[model samples]
Target: MGDYLVRAIGYNGQVRAFATRTTETVGEAQRRHNTWPVVSAALGRSMTAAVMMGAMLKGEDKLTVKIEGNGPIGPMIIDADAKGDVRGYVTNGQVHFDLNEYGKLDVRAGVGTEGFMTVVKDLGLRDMFSGQTPIVSGEIAEDFTYYFATSEQVPSSVGLGVLVNPDNSILAAGGFILQIMPGCEEETIESIEKHLSTIEPVSKMIEKGMTPEQILEAVLGEEGNVQILSTMPIRFQCQCSKERFGAAILGLGVKEIQDMIEEQGEIETQCHFCLQTYDFSEAELQGLIDEINA
Candidate 1:
């Protein structure tokens, strides 16, 4: 019912899949960013995919997905960890347009036809992994599908959708990712492709109150074929805090804090992820200066 993702192996481990119901998670982001309808779709879809990709990691590992398109929405960034926590934002959240020919949000027009999607992974031992591919389609799902196939060399099917209300709130948001494992039979891949063509959109399934497990079954087309491995709660979670920002201020050295104490009397910092503001009094600034001086 709430936001959560499921991991499963289908066709007796010949395929790996992930499904998530992210309505509440995307709703929280919609409220925080006040994104318009089209922009909401773009940001929500990217966040949904990012959280699933995060689940692919382990321990302290994490990743960031950057979508830089040439349209009005500007660049979007999402950060996610292995723990099912995610946070994201768009450079321009107030942009929207009329529906396209299919009577759906014009996400392609809002995202533009060219640009790049990049993924950066932090593996926590100074070892990093990064892959980038041109945005094959401004639609978030196709772009990720291309990313995995071309960048990671894995054949994948990605379905992402977000529906917004007239009042600019999120109605439903969810997605599924299906990847063919090495040595998968030709028959299995053909069957999955056939189902992918017929299954309803991910947003519609979520709107109809389907659970993540049910969504996976719908995509895989066999209720008994999926073996759910794990489930984890997902949400719009930001890691920024006052202490983290304070350390950043201290890294700015003594003169900057002194200037704030004298010229501005205090310093205030606002987090881009959550828009939460942190203020440091003149005394607090002085203490930071002392720490820098010491």
Candidate 2:
């Protein structure tokens, strides 16, 4: 019903898979950013994949996915954590185009055929991990598929889709990821490829009210072959807050706060993820200046 993701091991641990129903989550993003149809698809697809990747982490670990393409939509950035929280935005949310040759949102055209997809992971402590791959397809799914194979050295299949309503709202958004574990039999991989070719798009499945578990079964073939290991709720969650922004203002040092107090009288900061604005009065700015000097 609501947004959630399923992590499962299929074929008796021969393969690892993840599927998520993200309609509501993507809807929240669309409403916040007011993204056009094609841009909505691009952002929705990236968010879907990023949340799943986030599940691969543990504890306070988090990761950010950045797609920089040479198209009208500009660069897109998404951040997700191990807790199933994700937030994202496009450089230009208002960009859109007529349907492509397939009568679907022109995501490839909007994303462009050249660019890079980069992933940066913060593992907490002093550790970090980063990987990058060229944007082979501009379609979010295939680009991630390539990323895993080349950057992470895992053979993977990724399916992502987002349908937009005429009013520029999200109609359906969801996706699935399948990875061929080491020692997987050739027959198992062949079977998954066969089912992948026949199943409907991920967006259509979500539109028909298919749950994430059902999606895994359909993609992996046969209900008995897929074993769901865990399920976690997902949503469009931003870590930004007024207090956090205030702390950032303190980090700007004493002079900047004094300039705002004297010249501007106050400061207003708007979060790019959720579009929530935080206003600091002159008194509050002075307080920050005091803290900085203290």
lDDT of 2: 0.93
Model 2 segments more than 4 A misplaced: none
Model 1: colliding residue pairs? none
lDDT tens per residue, model 1, 1-294: 689999999999999999998899999999999999999999999999999999999999999999999999999999999999999999999986999999999999889889999999999999899999999879999999999999999999999999999899999999999999999999998888888899999999999999999999988887339999999999999999999999999998888788888999988899887889999999999988888878
- In order of appearance, the predictions have TM-scores of 0.97, 0.97
Instruction: Report the lDDT tens digits of candidate 2 across residue range 169-266.
Output: 89999999999999989889889989999999999999999999999999999832898889999999999999999999988889888988989998
Model 2: lDDT of residue 141: 98
lDDT computed for candidate 1: 0.93
